[model samples]
Target: MNKIAIIAACFIAPILILVTMGIMYWVNHNTLVKLDVACDSQFAEIDNMLKRRADLLPNLVNTVKGYAKHEKEIFVAVAEARTKIGSAKTVKEKSLASSMMDKALGRLLVVVEKYPDLKANQNFIRLQDELTGTENRIAVARTRYNEAVKKYNTKIRSFIGRLVAGGMGLEKRDFFEIENPEDKEVPKVDFES
Candidate 1:
């Protein structure tokens, strides 16, 4: 009886330990996968929002062109940035192009600001409103994407997660970070400048 009890304890202890380790590894791996998926989906949402904004830009540009034909340089810049965004293949490229679009659109809006008549145009106002809403949605999606990336990166960098994540082929993902240097700079508040 003593011999049987000793043998059972040794076998059961190892089996229990093995089961616990297995479960922990699985849970961690699954969590990383979920986070990865969330990041991808959030990026896609941002892309969709950006696409919506891009799609609406031409009409806005045309409406403004009717009022301000002299602002051809700014219009061309906006068009070029939009084309860059359309042709971008990678996340980094797309981010850069989107930033360019923002700057170009900012210039366009500033130009548009000079003309109250254009602002009052029903179609221009509607397009501006839609672009603003789309920009807001893109911001939301970027925040969510960063959050997902944070969670995923934290997991892969943690103790137990580090142990199994490499074996499972999980890697750290990048946040939807701002790539444009100008975007990082604080605008001069001095109206005198």
Candidate 2:
């Protein structure tokens, strides 16, 4: 009886340890993957909002052009910025393009201020409002994405997570951060005048 018990213990001990380790690894890997999916979804939402804003730009430009024809340079810049933003393929590229578009749009808005007719145009005002709302949505989505990435990165770098990730081929994900964060200051548009 004593010999049989010892034999069973020797056979079961390593197997139990391995099974527990496998469960731990699976749980960690699944959690990380879930977080990554959430991050990707958030980024997609942000991209959609940006695309909405981009779609609105041409109409806004056309409306402004009708009144501020002399500001050809501003109009051209806005159009070019929109084109670049539409063509951006990666998150980093999109961020840089978005910042450029914001600057160009700011300049366009400044030019629009000189034209009272453009300022009061209902279509222009409506499009501006829509763009503003989209920008707010983008900001919220980006915040969520960054938060998800932070959680995922923290997990993958932890002790047990490191082992799990290494065995499961999981890698850290990059946050969709602004390229030139300091340059993101959108010029104040005082349409009150």
Candidate 3:
């Protein structure tokens, strides 16, 4: 009501508002950066698991090759898929390459089905076990990476977060999704007779 009181209210109100806004912006920006780092870390875990699976493939291929020499096409396809996975630079590319591997390995497993002796081979058994373990690790890593991406994307797209993210130039991250609907089902790697 008084002149000095009104003047003080007007002056202090804007400073309080500005300080609150600055704090909110800082918090939002930090959240976005932290989510982004989490996405990167989880993706690295996926890459490591993929590399482990890739390493197991060759030995498995060799073991299968000793018995199924005539299945050259499947062997070649597996090799090419492995190469694509290694050379992939983006999330989509990696997903496609993984799908390719799944298809190729499925065919390879079908070939193995015809050869009873190969299934019983100790070397083949060991390689299959290692490959199975690697696949499980890959699945876990992929799930975590996707969860991180979901959080990051949600933050960047939310109303309040979008404003802060836009000012920070933050972008949505891609999920490690299955390229094909059929690929959603993991290929069974059972070697039991």
Q: Can you give the TM-score per candidate against the true fold? A: 0.92, 0.89, 0.90
Clashing pairs in 3: none
In model 3, the Cα lDDT at residue 172 comes to 81
Instruction: Tell me model 2's lDDT, rounded to 2 decimals.
Output: 0.84
Candidates' RMSD to native = 1.7, 2.8, 3.1
User: How do the candidates rank by TM-score, highest first?
Assistant: 1, 3, 2
lDDT against the true structure, per candidate, is 0.87, 0.84, 0.90
Per-residue C-alpha lDDT of model 2 across residues 91-128, encoded as one tens digit per residue: 78888888888889888888887999888999999998
> Could you tell me the lDDT of residue 106 within candidate 1?
88
The candidate with the higher lDDT, 1 or 2, is 1
Those runs of model 1 whose alpha carbons end farther than 4 Å from true positions after fitting are 189-193
User: Could you say which candidate leads in TM-score?
Assistant: 1
Clashing pairs in 2: none
* Candidates ranked by lDDT: 3, 1, 2
